[model samples]
Structures are given as structure tokens and as C-alpha cells.
Target: MAQVLEFRLPDLGEGLTEAEIVRWLVAVGDVVEVDQPVVEVETAKAMVEVPCPYGGVVTARFGEEGTELPVGAPLLTVAVGAAATGTTTGNGSSGGMPSAPAAGTPGTAAESSGNVLVGYGTGAPAARRRRVRPTASAPAARVAPADEPAGAAEARVAADIADDTEQSGPVPVISPLVRRLAREYGLDLRQLSGSGPDGLILRADVEYAMRAAGAAAPAAPAAPAPAAVPGPAPRPPAVPTPTAAPVPAAPAAERIPLRGVRGTMADKLSRSRSEIPDATCWVDADATELLAARAAMNAAGGPKISLIALLARICVAALARHPELNATVDTAAREIVRLRDVHIGFAAQTGRGLVVPVVKDAHRRSAESLTGEFARLTEAAREGRLSPAELTGGTFTLNNYGVFGVDGSTPIINHPEAAMLGVGRIVPKPWVHQGELAVRQVVQLSLTFDHRVCDGGTAGGFLRYVADCVEQPAILLRSL
Candidate 1:
């Protein structure tokens, strides 16, 4: 008889708890091999293809596309022992499971896989051993035919599927939908203290607990009463407490939920505003020399130099002088950490939303290399194919708001990073050059920095260095 095994969703690291099903790769009745991707899920971190561990017929699917499922929820179920025993054959339709021949067989006798996932494997864990019931009294004992209910494989499967509802512990979660709902509302399952049956936390239980918590929290105390005077008070008319007028209802409007990339951006931006005491400083500089240098480099060269890449090179040189600007703060330990490697991130806008793709070891890359990497990451961003690692761990951000035709902006600092440099449009403007008025290519640069990381002097020095390179590209020769 084939034993039915359940496959649960494995954890995709980086502290993600749940994922939304973007597409289903396999159906309920299809036969699947071990380690085959069964569903494509979109987590808060990135888009991932989740693989199934068990190899056999897919008994049941738990969720539909666009439905969110929490970790440890069942992705599918498979029968393990049928192929090893040769009792099940292809093209057989006993139940809803398709009995096609599986390619990645778990092997004979102890049929199972070794590489299931990071946390789970083909067989049961060592703590819980699987025991196969004895079928006969002796080696040559009676072997029941396939028709008898006592020895029938299909009958055993039916019985096993029927008894899946009973639980041996206090965790009484039976549906993935309930888990997803609880996660979406930010409810902790471990804190599932409820009077539910068998200590199970039900939907109503979570809802009631949240309501009780809200009700128990006291509102801000009424304005403190004035201190009493020593002398007796004169007769004073009581001032009526003014009642607040009711607010009128507005017309209904469309609503959209923030769950994926948009939600991640919102959370980070809000936290940055609340935690970082940031300030912005701006200065205008002549960029005619920088543009001419880039043109010269490309004109004589094998690899064309991009404007942003040149700006990145200049930023790297400036950070070498003012290392304090390339650092983040450890609030708990109250220490300022100066990073050794300069990983620069550039802001890219996509259909998904605004995302920052980091270029690792930006200090070591040449202008041509940085230009190539930026183009690759930007294209990936447009196609929404960037991985989580590509989107994180940036030491500093260089935002070219010039692409949007803006003169200046006090853009928010990408949280945890010490500062960001915003470059504006480089256009021809009238300026006094060497005692005569001339049309010069000018640009505005702004730096929004965390005040806690460095004092204003360090910030000003870094901005001034960047402006110097922009005005006289030859200044970069010493550092290069």
C-alpha cells in the first residue's frame, strides 16, 4: 500500500513569512517529481518559484492564484510507496490523482528523496519515524488479493485521507486560508491564547482578541487640570464644553491594497521618516567640463562612458576623502559603522513601482563597467525580474532626478544609508565665466543625509568635493 505524504511550503529566507500565489505550475491530478517547482509565489522580498519535495500524484492543491499562503501550509500531497512496490501503474485513475510514471523516484524499499528543500527532506524527520504496518504473520503467509478491502491500496489511501483532520497538539489550524488571513492582519500565531476548542485559534478568536486589545488601551489622558490656588476663587461662569461638529461623508473612491513591492517601499519610507533626523543641502555647479570629458572619453574609446557612471566615479572619489558619509548608525549600540566597501545604489522607476538596485563594490568598477551594470539592472527592473539581493545592501544612493526634468528636490534618504546625492538637469544657463558672461552647462546637486551619522561639516565637504569634480573633471585624475 502507498503511504500518503504531505508537502508543506518551505521558508524562503530574509524574514519573509507569507507569499502570494502568482501562478500554478501543476494541477491537482498531475504527477510531479521531487524538487520540481509547483507554484510561482510573490513574497515581500522577491518573486520565487517554490518546489515540491514529494514525488507522486498530486492529491490536492491548497490555494488559487492571487491567494496568499503562510509558511508551513500544505502545498500538495503525494503517494510515495506505490512506484517502489510496482502496485500502481501509469494511466490508472483510482482516485482524482493521476498515476503517471514519475521520473525522480525516491528509490525502492525506503522510497524517499535526499534533497527536498533546505529545512525539509524526502523522508520524515529523525524525531518522528515512519512505521509500515505488518501485512502477514510469516514470510510465506497469505497475501490478500487486490480486491479485498483488508489489503487494498486504494482503500488504505481513502482511509488515510479521511483521518487527516485529527490533531495531536494544541495547534488546530486546518486551512491555509485562515493562516494567510491572520498573517495579513499582523496577528501572531504563537500568541494564540484563546478559549477555542482544543486551544485552537479560530478566525473569530483572532478578531475578538484584536478588538479587546484596542478597547483596553487607554486614550491620551485629558489635558492635565490647572494647579490649585491657595486663596478662595471668585464666582466664575462655567464655560460650556464645545462639541465637535460631525464630518460629512465624501464620495466613494477606488481602493488598492499594498502588498508586494509597493508595500515594501511604503514601509521603508515611513520608517525612514520616523527614525532618521535628516536634512537636505543643495548647491549649483557648472557641468560643462564633466560633459566634455565624457564626450572625449567616449570619442577616443573602446567603451562609451555614461553620464551617470561618471557621476558615480566622482561620488566614489569624494567618499574616499569623506568616509563618514559612507556609513550607517547602529541605534541599539549607539555606534557609527563606517563601511569598507562602497556599494552604490541607483533609483530606477518601474511599472511595479520605484526600486533601488545596488551595485556591489562600486569603488572598484570602472566607468564602463558601472555603465554596463546599471543598464542591465535597469532593464531587469523594467521587466520586474530583479532578485532580492540585487535590491538591497546599498551603502549610498545616487539619484539622477534629471531624467524626470526636475531642477531640484529634497528626496528622502534611502533608510539605513547615510546619505543620497540627487543630480538635476544639466542645461545651458547664463553664467560669468572668467570675467565674461557665457552660456555654461549648469546642474543642481542636493544631498539628503542622516544628521546622526555626521556633522554638517562632513556633509558639506562631501558635496563640495562632488561639485569640484563636476566643474573640473581633471580633479578626478589625482584619485584615479
Candidate 2:
């Protein structure tokens, strides 16, 4: 007796509702092992491969390819029993048996579900789907004499097609319906060269061919002597060339049918934007001294510190001075959430999307420690290994657009916090030094705040204080 087990789509993290199936590695009747990748699903931001949760023989596929499956939906059925150990055979009554086409046939389906893992069970039935190839039947006509060379006849046919195309004008060929129409009309594509890019024939070409063939032939008339020419004839107005039709616009506000990371991002961003009252303050910082100090620190066996790491340290110090910047506003209870620890979340661009991984107890950590953590977080982010804990629970957020060569932008405040700091690129500009103009490395900082929690003056002062710390790195050491 075989024991059947159902494999439902798991909650792919972040309370997502659905995920678009990208590809299936296992098909019906194929054996799969636990923790082996069985399917790839595309979330809104990136494609993630889901692994098999149980070891068994694949019995059924619940949905077809390209289907958007909701979470908790049964995706595949598996059999767990003695036969499931090896040489597993599935029940054939309920579309569970593989029906793959034989090899060497046109459009033969390929099977990917074999012994995918080393030392995995074998002798499972192959589960592959067949794809149909289209065939066309042309109208019967008298065959041309073989005396005519194929090349010359093809050229004449091409010229005739060109003439017809010129008369009918241009047409697009993106839709499947258009291709079907062309095939049904018995349009000789080789004769009528395509007008589209890369020589793709259009619907207009077929229509023109049909119309030209249907037109009445000229009637025979008697030839006569030419009449005397009249005075210069008036020139006809210039006719404008027809433009290609614009590609169909997507529906206004496409229903993304959100799932996975996008769904989570939407919920979080909406809550932050709607619940938080944001305000911003601007400050220009001269980073000449900060750059020199960072170079010295790096040269002296300290980890290579980026401007973002230095700024984060300065922000932590400033928050220490003014605890309000680090506090969260609870409008519901009319209270402030002042936490004892500071977790500075620095926004890092990752393969999945924009993620802010936190540096826990940022204020307590030394500059070198923060630098090491930043490096680890960035590496984890790029490798798509950041956990929920690493991504969440931050007293403040920082966005560095300077890497993309941007000067400054008012970054949207990542919620639960009153503000976020935007760091810009450091560039050398003219500045007054002891009443004399000299080149100095300057950077613009934009701090976006939640107005409900902080006034403009408080926000401005906090930014100024942070800038002061950056201008004097020794200030951070003294504050600590």
C-alpha cells in the first residue's frame, strides 16, 4: 500500500499571498529528496528557488507552468511508502502518470526530473509534457516548370511582394493573432520580405498581396499619337509617411497581484509613509578633514572605512547627544519610544532589492567594529543571506546614493524612526580657508524627518551636530 503526501506551497516569508511559478524541476512520478530544489518562483523583486520539504515520489502537479499560485495551495502530490524508496511508480488514473512524447519527434518535450541529487533514489517514471508543433496546408496549384532557376524565380516573387508592400504601407507584427492571420492567408513570407526590424513580415504585407491579386486587370485600348504637352503642371502636395502604431499601454495602475518581498515591502512602506509625519533638514559638510582622518585610520591597520561608515558613527554619536533623534513617536498612546540600544540600519542595494540590514548597538561599537559589521552586512546582502533579524529593528536608517554619483536626495524616512539621513558624493569644491579660497572635499546631506516627532529646528540642529562630528573625528572619540 502507498501512502500519499501533499506538498503545498509554503509561506515564502514576509506573509506573501502568491508567487508566479518560474519553472518546475520535478514532474509527476519523479522522485525528489528533502531540501532539494524542486521549483523556481518569481517574487516581485527576484526569483527564488523553493526546495522540496519531504522525500518522496512526485505523484501529481496541481497547476500548469506560468500559473500564479496562492500560498498554501497544493502544488504537487508525493507518495511515501516502501516503493517510494526506489523504483517508485505513481497511480496512473488521475493524470499522475507521465505522458512524455518519444524522442526524435518535432517539439518533443524534455524531462528535467531525474536523479537530481547524488545518491538519491532512482528508477522513477519520467514526467515530461509534450508540446505541439504547428503545421500548414497550402492551396493546390499547378507546379511551375523546373526549367526556371530557383534563384531568379525567388527574385521575381520578392519584387512583386515588395511592390505590393509599398502600396499597402507598414504594419506591426507583435501579436499572435497577426501571425495566425498571415499563415491562414497562405502568405508567402519569403517572397514578401518583412518590413519590421530584423526582416519580420507584417500583417499589411499579406493584406496588400490579397488586394493586389483581387484588383481588376487593365482593359486593352488602341494606341494613338501623343498630344501636344501643356504648360508646367502644378506639383502635388507632399504626402507624409505613415507612422507605426504605438505599443499598447499597460492598464493604468497595473494590478501587480503582490506577493513575497514586494507584498511585504508594500505593507511596510505604506505603514511608514501613512503613519509617520516626515520633515527634512539640509546641511553641507566639508569632508576634507574627515577623508584625511579615514585614510590615516585605514593606513594604521584599522579596517578600510567608507564615508557611509564614518557618517553612521557620527550619527550614532549625535543621537547619543540628542536622544530625541533616536526615539520613536507613538502617536496612538501619545508617548515616545526611547530605546536603550541604537541599531543603525544602513540601506544596501542587494540582488533581491533594497534592504536595510542593521548594525546592532551601533552607539556602543567602536569605529573599527562598525566598519567590520558594515562589511559583513554588505556581503550578506549581496549574497542574499540576510535574515529577518539582520534586516529589522533599527532606531535610525541611512541611505547612501553617493555611490551612484548623485549629489543629494531627500530620502524617504524608513519608519518607526523620526528621520533618515541621505549621504551624497564627496567632491572637491572651492571654499574659503583663512580668508583665502581653497579646494575642499564637500558633501551635501539631506535629513528627512517625521514632523510629528521633531520640529524643523531640532532636525536642523541634529544634522549640524552630526556634521560637526564628521568634521572632527576626534569628537566621536571624546563623546564615547
Predicted model with the maximum TM-score = 1
Q: Supply the global lDDT for candidate 2.
A: 0.65
Tens digits of per-residue lDDT, candidate 2, 235-345, equal: 999999999989998888856555545565667788987888787778888888899998988888845776677888888877877677787987789998777788999
lDDT per residue as tens, model 1, 1-480: 344578778888777888888899986545567677998887776677888765655556888898888988887775443323343334241222222222244452222322221111122223332222222221222233546664464454334333432222112332233344444454444444423222323445555645655565557779989988889787899999999999999869977878877788889999899999999999999999999998898899697879999999999999999999899999999999999999999999888678999999999999999999999999888877788899899999999999999999998889899899999999999988899999999999999999998889999999999999999999999998
- Go through the candidates in order and give the C-alpha RMSD of each one to the true structure: 20.3, 16.3
Off by over 4 Å in 1: 1-4, 79-82, 85-251
TM-score of each: 0.65, 0.60
lDDT values for all models: 0.72, 0.65
Instruction: Kindly report which residue stretches of model 2 are placed more than 4 angstroms away from their true locations once superposed.
Output: 11-25, 40-49, 63-68, 83-259, 350-352
Number of clashes recorded per candidate: 0, 5
Model 1 is weakest, by summed lDDT over 10 consecutive residues, at: 115-124
Give the top-scoring candidate (lDDT): 1
